[model samples]
Target: MSTVEVILQSCLSKPAGNSLLVEQYVSDTASGRRYLLGRNEHAAEIMQMIEVDGIIDDFATNGTTWNNKPVLTTEQLPDQSMVVNCAMCIAPVSAARRLQKHGAIEILSLAELCSHLPQRFKLPWFVSQTRDEIRNHLSAWNSLSTALVDKQSQQTLNDLLHFRLSGDYHYMSGYSVRPEEQYFEPFIEPSAAHVFVDGGGYDGDTTEQFCHRYPGYRQVYLFEPTPTNLANARRRLKHQRNITFIAQGLSDQQGSLPFDTEAGSASAVDPQSSQQIQVTTLDQAVSEPISFIKMDLEGWELQALQGARIHIQDDRPSLAIAVYHQAADFRRIFDYVTGLYPDYQVYLRHYTEGWSETIMYFIPANIKQN
Candidate 1:
């Protein structure tokens, strides 16, 4: 008999709704791996009467089995006709789209299971933004959880997550694009006249937001590696005279690096690609006391940090580093900053749905941040 049959046989007397289990994240090094192990066992029991067939995940681990059943990858999910999709809370939009294409009857997660299930399974953590108790509970997932942030910042993260997941921002702060993210963060001021650097300045949308937030910056250095993006950014910022444009990649070193251009605004230097782009270190590019930096280098955040180490250490500019490219980045980026600038306190903010666009904000704890 197939694995699906066995699961169905085990639930012979249960309700007959079909189910598909999707593990949104599976990390081999972090707690995610262990959580995956538990989810593997939990997949069979929906905490509801719905019948479960098999498990699916995009993490795509090899040579792994759950309850002696082969844990299927996202690619393998369609083969088994599934009805309900029990996915990670706030899975990427792409994944949801793929599952929709496959005709998943319903998409649910641990946090949402209670809403669908007859009884709430004693899940480790449930998510609820409407209630501070649940929000505060799950906010402890990291040192930079929502519970630790200011009430406004906490509301901002929760509201952004809600909008990302459900297309609703009723609870969000007025600012959709957080140019000066820590605007709610007190006692922090822009250093000097403000030498703002916009990494991956696609079409200058962020630049526009930055200007709107604080129009008095001395100079704005905009970097867009692609010919296409640079042209559009130039057109967008044509009237803005205080801006300098660089048509190259930013990296940890001042040298050429390979890049994948097909990814659009997320394009970055790739060592294996045949393509090449001029790349430079921010430290090598500028000598002034830096004030604010905003980087969305796709997956090159860490390398870019290495490039700006001196500026960050000496000038102590307010940092907004993107840390969602790789799961390791979530922790590694924070560690890198804290190791270099121990005086700085690290906080995290997540934007976008699924598992993308999580920004880590590092501010000097010496300031009055309540």
Candidate 2:
């Protein structure tokens, strides 16, 4: 059976919580022999739920303490230590290999360690719903595979599917770090008349890249709902000409919705947050003809797409939408875009070594396919 099929079957046949990998590791390890790899928010979460001797971070000072745990590099990792990888942004297998090379005995990914934990502890994109969603939408997934314009895109889709289903970072071993070149693919031809829209423009990094790429662009609209992020974007792109900053979230409709401000770039419309931000549809927000739109609104891409249907149908702007936030988005976003304009040539690219930063590009039919 294929890797995707094998993983799907495995998830379908076996129930979760059957094997508590974290418990097993703890039971097998002696006192003070446990370590966690990486010292990010993920590591903090893991530390709250379990005990560890120290946190391993190559960049941190050897004697410093992170979350009150001793910070040590892989070079200082004790012999026969059991390490749990908490670096969600990078490939777990690569981290494991590094730890092993440094004399560490055992390594487990955050996903594998938390696989038996409650659903609340599951990481984004690696949640329990992933397998069932893929299984239910098998036909849609197949259609998306056929819709991709290149073999690399098809392989990326397959690899991502396998990784999400199995929580095996080995599938992402071939991925490289190229987040800077994300929205600006070689397939897209730059034009001086390009009018760009930066949806979810956090800190103006993407807008800066766009300005750098298309220096003579006529106009640029940057939308960021978070107050701090909007201020940062403005400060960063203050000198750029013909730029409009809209401090509102993008959605299918106009209104206010609760938003979580503390999550930084991952912030979105969360009903749980006491803070609320105004939202507007792209069609209503911009009256000018748009040549391109790049959206990375966490998991709200679909809703924003629905709101921008008019612009997509009329302007047919080249689209670069993030699809890694949710598993169903792999097929849902492609289907939605093509459903609106059947001639859009679709392409997929992943930036990180993990499940994040998967972008689905939609180049209009008028643009010559490369």
lDDT of 1: 0.57
Q: Highest lDDT: which candidate?
A: 2
Which tens-of-lDDT digit does each residue in 134-209 have in candidate 2? 7787777767877889998878877877677756566678887787998888877675138999999999999999
Tell me the whole-model lDDT of each prediction, alpha carbons only: 0.57, 0.81
lDDT of 1 by residue, 1-370 (tens): 4322232233322332222233322111232121211243235555233334445565758756665555666555543243233443244344455655656334444433332232544232212222233233232333434223465545445444443222222222243333344222333464522778898887888887777666677888988888888899999988886899998777899878888877777677677789888888899887777877878898888988899999888877777778756545655677687778777755566554434566777776554311
Screening candidate 1 with a backbone cut-off below 3 angstroms (N, C-alpha, C), the clashing residue pairs are 91-354, 92-354, 258-270, 259-270
Kindly give the stretch of ten consecutive residues in candidate 2 with the minimal lDDT sum.
11-20
Q: Which sections of candidate 1 miss by over 4 Å?
A: 1-193, 366-370
TM-score of each: 0.57, 0.86
lDDT of 1 at 18: 20
